[model samples]
Target: MSGHDHVRFLTKNMRVDLALIAGMIAPGSRVLDIGCGDGSLIDHLFQTKACDARGIEIDMAEVTQAVAYGLPVMHGDADVDLAHYPDNAFDYVVLSRALQAVERPREVLAQMLRIGTRAVVSFPNFGHWLVRWQLLATGRMPMTATWDRPWHETPNIHPCTIRDFFILCEEEGYVVEQWLAADDGGRRTPWRRFLNLANIFGEQGVFLLRRR
Candidate 1:
């Protein structure tokens, strides 16, 4: 299918975090998306912004699906594959909803900033009030929309909060260009102005960052 057709098929189907990450990227620039399931974001970027968008997905099934749809997605792991790219190879490297799943998230993030001018990362906020409330009420792992899978079955290993991410950025000397807390319902603006409030209420945290 054409890029336009692929994008049309993906409208409203794109994850809220992916849309937010796309908005942070400039048009007509190179983009690399990690854990890019079926290359939906890449298709959207290529069709709408004229970006040279490509992706790497660990799942061979997803890689094949993306390739069938004419997307440039390779089977690769973020923990290892990112090191092969040269410095500043792209304008942006995006990791949407997959940071916590990577075995070495900090290293992956560093590699992303190394190979791209900027990095956009989005992950479920473990500090959300709903998560806390659920855990407290049930004495078990929470199961919200973002964290739906059972603890034993979930891919997330090092789930972090918005505050935790901010601290990591500070420790790594990465500049936070922009950040926001958004929900799955496509509401991107709520609680963005208040970090503490966002940590309590926001379902997820999206951040655009660059190395200091």
Candidate 2:
């Protein structure tokens, strides 16, 4: 099946970023999902890919709900608890759509790469043309599906663009194995191949990475 078809087939309720994260993972791999929300992706991975999936969410309510559904989830903060995992404990560590919200994005990514052979990270892009135009037009934050929350009500503290992330990876000596820019509709374009266009048009991005 195509990647989009696989993601669409696996989950109808998942966000586009989560679907892309799922598509990046290898089947039957041990996976750690940070900021996994209510464990929809974890559940999907376990049932569909035969993965031994576990999740860490900061929300107690979400943890409760996921536990009730028989998903292995712990109420934990990504910024604080990611350090506790031993090195190379999982095949893939995923942080989907939560990178900008984390207190220490660089630190969390370092820990993720340390604990797993591969890491999947996804987040909304602040450099989209709409955002830039909105800032220029109204001098205010733009409202899009991926970044719909108002500035006062949002958890995101460190919004970055695809270019910004690339610079961060370069500084941290991480390797970008694969990356793509996706629209809010879960459709992925050749963002990696045609990056300049993607940076302006793509609403979000997903990346598969490892340490150098």
Candidate 3:
């Protein structure tokens, strides 16, 4: 599909993030998206760029929706199911806004990298200035739109910062190819320069990484 067709299919809220991932992926590449809620990204990739797309989702409702769109998807968890794929089965793997909910982030990431040549990961930045201020002053867990859950009801079990992610990546032997920070609606921010410090100030961040 043409670039114009790609842009026309995406909602305003999804455009920036989708474009970021699209930029990194070669046309017609094979892709595997983990935690692919509703398969929106995969659908976009298949419909617009002719990418060979597949998804793994834990949510059955989302799995239904993804299948309804004629997208290939399996019901499974990232931490466990990625082991089924052979080494370098896909050109790219994606984990968007789902890492924080995983029980073993490092393990999942390692598996993802092994299964795909490159990976794109996007997550809420727990170190944004607003979150910091809220914690510093109120001493309460944050409840921003991105993290809109009461402490007792939250699904995110491993909230982390950009610095934490970088350290984890280094220890796991993954190289950071590119990094971008985003706000609530996927709007880009100038937080790349302060990635380590970004945990104290960035709202969200995305990383393009490759296995070492």
Candidate 4:
């Protein structure tokens, strides 16, 4: 099925980014989701796409909840536990909305590519115009629907812009196969084709990548 069609197949309530990530995976592929809170994506992949989908979440509470639902999920940390997996264990390794919280973002990304043929990542764009304007106007960290946490209370530590991620990919020799900017409403930013404009307007960025 086409990515757009897969997006349509999913419930509207799923986070736009998660729907996008789901769209990227091929049917019946193996997928591993890091920081898979509640295993929502895993459930969707298994049920809708017939994927061998499982998750590793840092929160034990979420792990238990996922297990209770009969989903395959385990309590594990993305920062350190990723190393336990063998090389090229899955077709896709997904890290959604949790990139900023990992203590070693670079290392974690390297591990993702090492263990899977491709990686799908989505994160809030810290370079959105609203974020920049709020910081400039109020001299404080900005908050939006996607970044709805106070500075002291938020788990994000390495928040990055779309441009920043592109640079990282380039520097690390990772190939960006597909990318887009969107908001929580599932609407792709009109300027998604234009990086500069998208960076200023997109609430979040989603990327499909593979090793060079």
Q: Measure candidate 3: CA RMSD.
A: 6.3
Q: In what order do the candidates fall by lDDT, top score first? A: 1, 4, 2, 3
Candidate 3 lDDT over 1-212, as tens digits, reads: 11222112222234447666776778899999887667888888988899998998876776787799888998887878999999999999998777787778888888989999999997777877777778889999987766676877666778888888888889888999988777766666666677665566667778999988
Candidate 3: misplaced stretches above 4 Å?
A: 1-16
lDDT of 1 by residue, 1-212 (tens): 11222222223335666678888999999999988878989999999999999998887777889999999999888888999999999999998877877889899999999999999998879999999999999999999877766888666778999999999999999999999998876577567989999999888888999999
lDDT of each: 0.85, 0.82, 0.77, 0.85
Ten contiguous residues minimizing lDDT sum, candidate 4: 1-10
| lDDT value, residue 179 of candidate 1 | 94
Error of 4 at 190 (Å): 1.8
Residue-wise C-alpha lDDT for candidate 4, range 1-212, written one tens digit per residue: 11222122222324667778998999999999988777899999999999999998876666788899999998888888899999999999999877877789999999999999999998878999989999999998898766676887667778999999999999999999999999767678789999999899988889999999
- Taking all chains together, each candidate's TM-score versus the true structure is 0.92, 0.91, 0.89, 0.92
The 10-residue segment with the lowest total lDDT in model 2: 1-10
**Candidate 1 or 4, higher lDDT?**
1
Is 2 or 3 the stronger prediction by lDDT?
A: 2
**Residue-wise lDDT of candidate 2 within 1-212, one digit each (tens)?**
11222222223325666668888899999999987777898998998899999998876766788899999999888888888999999999998877887778999999999999999988878989989898899988887666666887666778999889989999999999999998877688766578788889888888999988
* Pairs with backbone N, CA or C atoms under 3 Å apart (clashes), candidate 2: none
Which regions of candidate 2 deviate over 4 angstroms? 1-13
